[model samples]
Target: MTLADILASLFPAGHAVRVTDGLVSGDGPLGASRLAVVGIADRTALGVDGACTLSRHVLDVVQSGDRTPILVVVDSDSQRMSRRDELLGLNEYLAHLAKTLLLADAAGHPTLGLIYGHSAAGAFIATALATRVLAGLPGADPSVMDLPSVARVTKLPLETLQAMARDTPVFAPGLDNMVAAGAVHAVLDPDSPLGPQVEALIGQMGADDIRDRLGLERGGRPVAHTIAARVAQDAGGG
Candidate 1:
């Protein structure tokens, strides 16, 4: 779906969002409350300027002192891969955007991500992955890292990486893999009204981050939750 289509489906009641340069920000009615919406659109490559812009909006929401739920609608390319972006410290800008979202979540705002289209790499992390709950619509393609890039980094053959991905959800790209790895908490039915599904998800959210546990239960990265728990326990004892 296009961003407009997704927004209409998500806010059947109404919305006041503005999209400029692929950056989205606004509010939408959500059953007795308003959801503060912020995100990227148009499959644009996220850059330092986009990251800083998003972070500023999130910080504005946080400072408002409203316990409003935040919705991050994502449709982005990977972080911009240009010499200019590198020289401008794109990583730091992305980190700031992620931190601002985390702060909003920590400050009693329920932060949720809805992926309706392509999202990848650091752009995915700073927006969708930072959210407490991430839901995806059918055909949402979110990739932390693509196989070609992984092959280059790991010095593994492309065919070998593809074969491994077939068996493991660990670093694969797709909605199924993301769900298996617990990056996506839910996949809404495209046949149904998305507004109700989004509302239900908001109602079901909890304070704890359960992605690791979900990953273990779903048979993706089976040792992650166990190792994390052990480390936490050991740190507390020390």
Candidate 2:
């Protein structure tokens, strides 16, 4: 499904949402408060400008001294690969965006990532990875790099990589694999109306992030929780 389709389904009939330059900001569900949604459409790459705009929105919510939930809509293939962006410290701008979201969360606002489509590389890091909870649509996939690109870089046969993906989700590129790896909290059903799910999640959001535990319980990820708990216990004993 397209980004517009998802938004329309989530915020239908006088939702008062606004989309400009591929950034969304306006009243959230039930007209409770302000929120932001950023997506990449028109094959647009999220560059420094988009990053700065999103960061500004988060800062605005923090300055208002109200808890505003920020929803990041992930649908981008990659960040804009431009020499100018790189020369002007694109990584730093991305870092600034991530830190701003963290500040917002600290200020009582919650950040959520809704993966509706292709999410990868630097774009995913700057947008979705910063959020507290990450939910994905059925077809959504978040990966460090697409398999074709990985194979090209590693000089491995494409068939070999594909076979490896079947055996190890670490090499896979799908929403289920992301859930298995503890990178995605859940894979939402595409057929169901998403509004209720989104609203319920927003109402139940808390500071405690449970993706690691969830992955272990669901048998998607095998050891992240174990290792993390062991480290936490060791640190506590020290």
Candidate 3:
């Protein structure tokens, strides 16, 4: 879906968001309230500049003191892979963006991510993965790393990785895999109106990060939650 289509689905009532240089910002109606939107579009590869721009917008929202719900819509490539970006400290910029989102959530502004198109790697992490809850639209493609890259890094054959992905949610690039792995909190039903589903997810939002528990409950990463809890308990932090 185009960004326009996504906005339409998300706010059937109406919206006033503007997309400039692939950066999305503005407000939209959400039931009886309003939501602040900060996102990327046009399949942007988040470089240092884009990351800085997005972080500023999120910080503006955080400083607004409204506690408005935030929706981050993502349609981006991985972080820009360029020597120039590296020299410009792209990692720091990306981290800043992710931290700003976390800050928004921490400041009582419920943050959610809606992945309507492809999102991968650092771009995904600094946006969708940083949200309090992430929802994927049908056919949305999300990847932490692509198979060929994983294959090259692990010295495994492409066919082997593909076969492994079929059996496990890890090492794959699909909405279902992400959902099973608990990275995606929900998958919006394509047949239903998106507005209600989004509202329901907003209503269900809590302050805790529960992806590890969801992974265990969904049988994806079955031991992750237990191990985390054990470590926390051992440290007297649970």
Candidate 4:
């Protein structure tokens, strides 16, 4: 089955799933009955459109407050390639949606994400902003795409590009690599106690905030420290 089909099975339906084109935004089972979900179809699922859809949904959820969960489901392929989208303020829309997500967290909402499909680039970044991130099995591919695609524009060689991807978390695919970079909070089996676990997370949250240490990133997960050390090094300090 596709990612949406799997998520539909995992998250019980109660929220108002918004569907415009092929983009869908909603709070799965943990969300309130009136939560907004949006979907995008075809090439229209480009930059500005996707960002606008996300912004609108986020705003609606923030206005709804603690009544619903902020569960984001990611199953995207890529961002806008249209030159018109580039000309338009697509970046503004992305920033707007991102800020709205932060606002949702501050307003006491459980922002959880289930990535059952490809979460590439902006779509991946959007989903990862959640309080908790869950990846189910090996169905998802999280590459920034192969170096050949980049090389088509940059004229870089396959060997050189492959070498770079070997060391960078940015180019890795699959959940193992993503988990190594702390991109996901946990990996759920299709038959695991996902629902109850999510509910437990909701109950344990004294406030809407998701604790970094309590989730999958901490508790001696090897990748957690690896990613952390990278960040620290990037920041120019220990």
Among these predictions, the greatest TM-score belongs to 1
Distance (Å) between predicted and true CA of 222, model 4? 8.4
* Model 1: worst 10 consecutive residues (lDDT sum): 1-10
Best-matching candidate per lDDT: 1
Q: Please provide, for model 1 over 1-238, each residue's C-alpha lDDT reduced to its tens digit, 9 standing for 90 to 100.
A: 7788877887887799989999999988888888899999999899999998999889888999889989999999999999999999999999999999999989989899999899999999999999999999889999999999999999999999999999999779988999999889999887777778888998898877889999999997788899899999999995
Error of 4 at 223 (Å): 10
TM-scores vs. true structure, each candidate: 0.97, 0.88, 0.95, 0.71
Q: Predictions ranked by TM-score, top down?
A: 1, 3, 2, 4
Clashes of 1: 0
Give the runs in model 4 whose Cα sits over 4 Å from its true position. 1-4, 11-18, 26-44, 129-136, 144-146, 149-155, 167-171, 200-238
Encode model 2's per-residue lDDT on 1-238: one tens digit a residue.
7777877777776466567876665655645554556545443567888788878877877798777677778777677799988888888998998898788777777787888878788888887878888888877767878889889999999899998888776568788887777778766666787777776677777867787787787677778788989999999995
lDDT of 4 at 138: 52
Over 4 Å off in model 3, which ranges? none
Residue pairs in clash, model 1: none
Q: For residue 98, what is the lDDT in candidate 1?
A: 94
Clash pairs, candidate 3, are none
Report lDDT per candidate: 0.91, 0.76, 0.90, 0.57
| Of candidates 2 and 1, the better by lDDT | 1
